[model samples]
Target: MKKLTILFLAMVIFSCNNQPDKGASDNNSEIASQGKIPKTEKEVGSNTTINDYSQVETEKAVEPDTIKTNDNQDINYQPADNNNTNQFEDNFIGFASFYMQFDKPKQTFILKADEDKTITCKEGTKLTVNENSFITSSGDSVTGDIEIRVKEYYKISDILLANLSTTSNRDILETGGMIYIEAFSNGEECELKKGATIEIAFPAKDKKDDMQLFSGNWESDKVNWILKETIPVDSEENAGFTFVEKMPEFPGGQQKLMDYLSKNIKYPTRAKESGIQGTVYITFIVNEDGNTEDIRVVRGVDSSLNQAAISAIEQMPKWTPGKQGGEYVKVNMNLPIRFSLGGEDFSTNNIDYAKEFEKQVNDSNLSNTEMLEISHYIFSTSKLGWINCDRFFRDNSPKVDFLVNIGTSKQVDIKIVFNTINSILTGSTSGGKYIFDNVPTGHSVTLVALKYEKDQYYLAIKKTKITREEEQVLDFEPVTMARLKAEMEKLNRI
Candidate 1:
């Protein structure tokens, strides 16, 4: 505690003596780690008496002569020397117009607190987070390398009004957009005071915002959306998805959600017992086609429980209704799900949630000889516009070579990835391609096609050292996504 206070005092004095000349530039870019939207802050305004600060050690010492002068002179600068004016401000503020949308209002903020402060969060301070989504250090204090983030503060209305050009502007004129701050106490959680600042640096899109990657559509119900893709230009799927003209339509909608919740939304009894009552935040993107892809748990609890939540969201129905300019648009929504021990059975008599689990969840059929034969080749003029052979053997196959050539897609490479490498199929000399002549006759074995990932495909065919030789050509059929999922469940049953 004493050391932290001393450090804070030292940094404050450093600030007063050293004022680096910052360039006339603000380049704000955001990066991501563990989960969704990149952001963070340290624990502030915490009770000094309760949380342990005794073991907190002083900052590490840096070797001298490390900081070079413009002339590359050996000025012998030590990092701990607070008088060096060459360092940048450890605090920074970032402002972005509304989410991936156009026409959002924006704000510019000033971040305080140097990395050396050893400070805790108060109700209205900003924090620059690390990969763990928490502020571990104050961050780079060098002038040219300052990182920007606000702890827990809000924009002032007067500050908001300053960014506007006229009273007629719908954005600047909106008042409720203000933020609030509250501090936690004894047993009562802190609630934001009516006008306390809520460092809401990320503003909404106003009438005059930039549109480039922000265009999207909302379905009539507004529950479903098809947001614009934010993928980089150099991505493999460059063309991306086409823009949907109507409000995005969800195939399952509420019913799918109900079933998903009922079947998979199991309560984390242990965590609940521990009294962690925070809401589980789930987020994912809805593609233009109404499919829920990239499901992830933004805020997590127990690892196993987190997976359960993700599974529930992933099995949801395609959404409908998201529009832009009255056209359905794709989008990503942050969802909050609450859990309690009582939530064990999220079902009513009319609905059997597990029953709605349309398909099985495993694919052990990989050990079936028949499955391998049935899935060998694609039927010409097949029902599917394009077949993903890799998916047929998802993670299990007899032949190790993973080759997939569908119409004009990229040259699908094939490699065999296995849970166990020395098993019969993986070590084949012919790239997992089967040769009947190499085996003895009259042996019985099973074969199943398996696909782990790109460049890895296999046939789950058993090598029967059969004395009686029988040669049979096989064709493995590609199953629909739903069917593939059902196969997975079927394996789980066994």
Candidate 2:
């Protein structure tokens, strides 16, 4: 009996020691409710979680500081607490911190969505760091902080377009743009170190869907992303598409079109002798039937050269029409015809042919037809004579300036016509100011401003006389919010 009692007491003591603490049970239940399991002591630095405590080599445990980095400011070399081993559930989100400097290591900012607060990070999240380089519109290497602002969250059901920032301002991140992202298993901020790199994953089955994971750093409105992975994406095609899946092609291809242009185009004798060598900009529509029509010269160098281009296009064979959403659609295309005097034409000439042609056109006092011919020649050779040709011949032409006042709005378009000796000169405004360089004196000019208020057209007109060699200014009434409201009220009554 004594031996049996001793054995039973030993067994009871063993069971008591094996049981989990009551506080621990409550903590584990809370963690499971949040959709996450706590990492075991052995898994602290493994690839399973982002908050890998193993990556942090602390000599001893210490209290962490609550330090906040300034948003949109360059982070200096101040290290935050790295010893925190707190873990987060899968629902938490991590934002990519695009550090301004190129050489600095990138970090991820973590936030608990349900709690709307920061979370602890673990180490050992798979990290794949790669050096990336980008060029700007000015051909300079990007060096500023790239800001990425999350405009809206579509809750994984609708399309999501994030606002990617530039040095000047934030613009919508374009679909199929280079920016991409992925999420890690663990979502915690403390896992990220000052210089540590993280792995990126695209968890979505369909990468083409609107919403996806973006993991990387920002360099002052410039995005220096290292990885892009997708989340679970819907299979249905997005409702709208701005760009076609496949662009329209010529019957034989682009090479064939080039060959046709080269074989068919003939230089006009007038244009050749006058040294008119430039590109004529032509725009046309390729119909759903693949036939080309509505050919016009948007920017002309010379009439003869423009005619040559138009004739070539009119004789072109049917092309392979563009398709949008699996159906053939009419597409507008722009083509430039180059009229260069090269290869057996002006190869041996000593004169600057282009300049000589301009001078010849300027010196001539010809009829309107002849003036247009010269204008066409100049325009085709160098895109120079797109405006009124009469100004080149008249020495003492009057000038008029339209000073438009639309109340701090530069989005309005202003148009004016100065009539002189059977010729009408059209001038448009450049940022609320329009200048008519050379107009014949003693002629009546008409000015018109078209303002659209809530899709309704408002026209303002003024008639004035032009004086020779003198500058004239005309101001239009400002379009104010009050005026627009009054106009809206009147339209409602009607």
**Strongest candidate by TM-score:** 2
Estimate candidate 2's RMSD in Å: 33.1
Please provide, for model 2 over 417-450, each residue's C-alpha lDDT reduced to its tens digit, 9 standing for 90 to 100. Answer: 3333212232434654554443445656555443
Total colliding residue pairs, candidate 1 = 102
Q: Model 1 off-target regions past 4 Å?
A: 1-260, 263-280, 325-329, 342-494
Model 1 accuracy (lDDT, Cα): 0.26
What tens digits encode model 1's per-residue C-alpha lDDT throughout 420-491? 111112111143343222222222433333321121121222222223324333333433323333433332
Q: Which ten residues in a row have the lowest lDDT in candidate 1?
A: 6-15
* Cα lDDT listed for each candidate: 0.26, 0.33
Superposition error at 270 for model 2 (Å): 1.0
347: Cα error in model 1, Å? 24
TM-score of 2: 0.29
